[model samples]
Target: MKLKICLGLLMLTLGGCSSLGVEPWQKQHFAREDMALNHEKLDLSLDDHIYFSKEGSSGGRAFAGGGCGCN
Candidate 1:
């Protein structure tokens, strides 16, 4: 029936998500500097500071500073 087909499809879709992330052995490759989200750490930090100063919110990647732009 249509209900059974829908249930099977839903189960199939949900099951596919289990394989969607980095495996244990793949962590080393993903942790490499070349694989970093932002290749330039200094530029990324400057951008983060600008974002925090504009949005009045902070706290990410161990950065500790206020939004007053005092540095």
Candidate 2:
């Protein structure tokens, strides 16, 4: 009961998703190697450290998130 309510509250607080409707050619520029979220791997490590310390999330080379531990 309490857990269910807490889960619902958490989901509601997370906000809804958005879609850019991007296409293949439209993503060409964003596909560049240097356009990655971690082009030099330095920010990747820093982000991972922050995430681990605050959210307990960990992953590599992927966009993952669904309220799961692997996210």
Candidate 3:
């Protein structure tokens, strides 16, 4: 029936997702500098400082105010 076919297809799709991540031995390769989110660390830090100063808030701090510029 169509229900059985859909269930089998769903199961197959879900099963395929289990092999999607990096293995233990592959972690070292992924941790290299070339795989970093911000290749220019200084530039990224400067940008963050500028944003925080312009918004007048230090993000993720233990303060009592919102820092996302929505207020």
Candidate 4:
């Protein structure tokens, strides 16, 4: 049915995305300290804060929320 068609298309798409085997040295330019997952701590903190206030969930916020009406 529709599910089978979707699954087959997804499989074909993923199969075509396979890499052609690049050596470690060839990828050295992509492996840098400044190109890290989190290059700035302050920007990450702001994103977390926005997620917490909007989603009613908070963690890694340095302090726990009080058991009150505030989210």
Candidate 5:
């Protein structure tokens, strides 16, 4: 009986978190250009290209070394 009550309380607590997310209509707000995670896509790509080229390695955004000591 005690275990059943604890499980019910836990279920109710978990169910309360379901109301915390965004609704369907609110999605459109996030889809706007101003809400983008990366506003300057092209510029960022160009910068990355320049940086990688100067680095002289095909390393990515990780802790990849430059032209030397990349292994």
Candidate 6:
């Protein structure tokens, strides 16, 4: 019984990992414009400009604007 349970668990783990990666045929779907990380360059640039203007600081930070915006 122990051997059967271990084998079942191992098979389940392996089966779960077998489909973890993207297949070659699915590359076309993943390469679509809607799937991009930054889909709109112009809008992203404009947002970056607004963020910089409001926060008065550049990258390397996470929290919203409130303090002197140093660092």
Q: Identify the leading candidate in terms of TM-score.
A: 6
lDDT of candidate 3 vs native?
0.69
Report lDDT (CA) for all predictions. Answer: 0.78, 0.66, 0.69, 0.69, 0.70, 0.71
lDDT of 2 by residue, 2-46 (tens): 999999887776643233357778888898999877697887766
lDDT of 1 by residue, 1-71 (tens): 99999999999998998868877887998879888877887887888777776676666774667646454
Candidate 6 lDDT over 47-68, as tens digits, reads 6657777665555433443434
- Which order, best to worst by TM-score? 6, 4, 1, 5, 3, 2
Residue by residue across 21-70, what tens digits does model 3's lDDT show? 88798799778997787677787666666666667646452233434454
Q: Give the range of the ten consecutive residues with the poorest summed lDDT in model 1.
A: 62-71
Candidate 2 RMSD computed on C-alpha atoms after optimal superposition onto the true structure: 9.4
Tell me the TM-score of each prediction against the true structure: 0.40, 0.34, 0.36, 0.45, 0.38, 0.46
Q: Alpha-carbon error at 71 in model 6, in Å?
A: 18
Clashes (candidate 2): 0
User: Model 4 — TM-score against the truth?
Assistant: 0.45
Model 6 spans > 4 angstroms off: 1-20, 60-71
Model 1 score (lDDT)? 0.78
Q: Which pairs, if any, clash in model 1?
A: none
